[model samples]
Target: MGHDKSGINNELFFGEKNAFSKKYEAILYNESKALSPSAKVYFNQINAFLAMKKGKADLAYTHMQRIRVLYSWYPEIKENNYNEYLRSNRNLCIVLMHQKRFEEATEVIDQLQKP
Candidate 1:
């Protein structure tokens, strides 16, 4: 899920309907109501990624950080799932970078590489 997602072309984000990130996002918000809290976390992930793309790093960070809360919403989420690690650290890096916290961003990038 490294963002340049040329494969998700049918999505309204790419073409003439570029304003569709918000449009599709409304759909995600509505769909989230039908999901379990566990499954609902994906909406935050999607919102975070879209915010990143739109250069709203702070908002992106908020959504990414929400995952921690969402994860703890159920014991089924586990202590530190690998995908959670990847997603959180990756988005945090983006936020840190935007804030000019290069040292902190580097540390997060380093942490993301940890075993």
Candidate 2:
């Protein structure tokens, strides 16, 4: 997804049906009897997007980076959640690119392509 101003604005909901990202996020966190590790990872991913929408690129980068650490909590996560792993990496690379950190973005790409 491109970081266009209109895109972010369109993603924001004004009324009902999960008014704010964090409100839904708290439901995701507290309503569950036991929050899954994978769910936490997803929260970070969504938070990253929300951060970007709010023009907090630095915080967005932090959230994306946290995905990797969360995955490490369970050895099989990267293997089982392969798609999400790639997605998070891809988003991280995007943030890096936006910051003009081409080298780091390339490194992430190289890592993503490894067998």
Candidate 3:
């Protein structure tokens, strides 16, 4: 039988947190070798999420820097996928807040609120 999408979603939703780490890491490592610009942004975001989850604020910030660098070359991100961008931005803001970088977190939130 084919893989069950619902089962995969359920596992992702409520199973072990690191359940997808290996897959994500492999994809990220391979993508890094290929240097796919789009993949780099996603890899950085996933790394940042993992770092944040592990209470590694500094590492998360470094990954966030990668994202910022990627975004700097494309200022029209808000017009591309505003909802997804806002979601990712919000997650970063939360991580920054955990690290007590209130100013930076506030800036992200402000940007997300903009039209």
Candidate 4:
């Protein structure tokens, strides 16, 4: 699925309802087996998107946190186009605000506003 302006897939990443989570988990697990850091990070973004779709705020936060960690260490990611990353970070902040985690959301927003 291609990213929309929100950095999430325009169409459902996995499927409708719980199907997305199931498919996402399966793909994430399979990709993790290859020990490719970049692949793992990308799949984690998918997982976050699925969680957000399902209204699983806590799970979404956790997945977004993982993405932040992955971003911190991956030099290749810095060299590549990071528009998706910025969009994803903004989306995560919105999710956190919806969940009433204002402090955490503010942190994300502040980071995003940085150069």
The TM-score leader among the candidates is 2
Lowest summed-lDDT stretch of 10 residues in model 2? 9-18
Residue range with the least summed lDDT across 10 consecutive positions in model 3: 9-18
Q: Tens digit of lDDT per residue, candidate 4, span 1-115? A: 5567889765555455345556445566654553776776777777677678667988878888887887888857745858867877887887789899889888887877787
Task: List lDDT for all candidates, in order.
Answer: 0.67, 0.75, 0.68, 0.73
Give the range of the ten consecutive residues with the poorest summed lDDT in model 4: 10-19
Best by lDDT: 2
lDDT of 1 by residue, 1-115 (tens): 3235566654354443678655665666653563776556777777777777767888887886777576657646645466764666777777878879799889867755666
- Model 2's TM-score against the true structure: 0.73
Query: What tens-digit string does per-residue lDDT give for candidate 3 at 1-115?
Result: 3226655553354334456755556665543553655567778877787676566889888888777777667656535755756666777787788888999888887865666
Q: How well does candidate 4 score on lDDT at residue 110? A: 85
RMSD each, Å: 5.6, 4.8, 6.1, 6.0
Candidates' TM-scores? 0.60, 0.73, 0.64, 0.69
Candidate 3, which segments miss by more than 4 Å at Cα? Answer: 1-20, 76-78, 112-115
Q: Where does model 4 exceed 4 Å of error?
A: 1-25
The residue-by-residue lDDT of candidate 2 on 1-115, one tens digit each, is: 3335666535445223336655566553442433777777877877788778677889889888878788777758788968878888999998998889999999989977777
The alpha-carbon deviation from the true structure for residue 2 of candidate 1, after best TM-score superposition, in angstroms, is 18
**lDDT for residue 91 in candidate 3, whole number 0-100:** 72
Ranking by TM-score: 2, 4, 3, 1
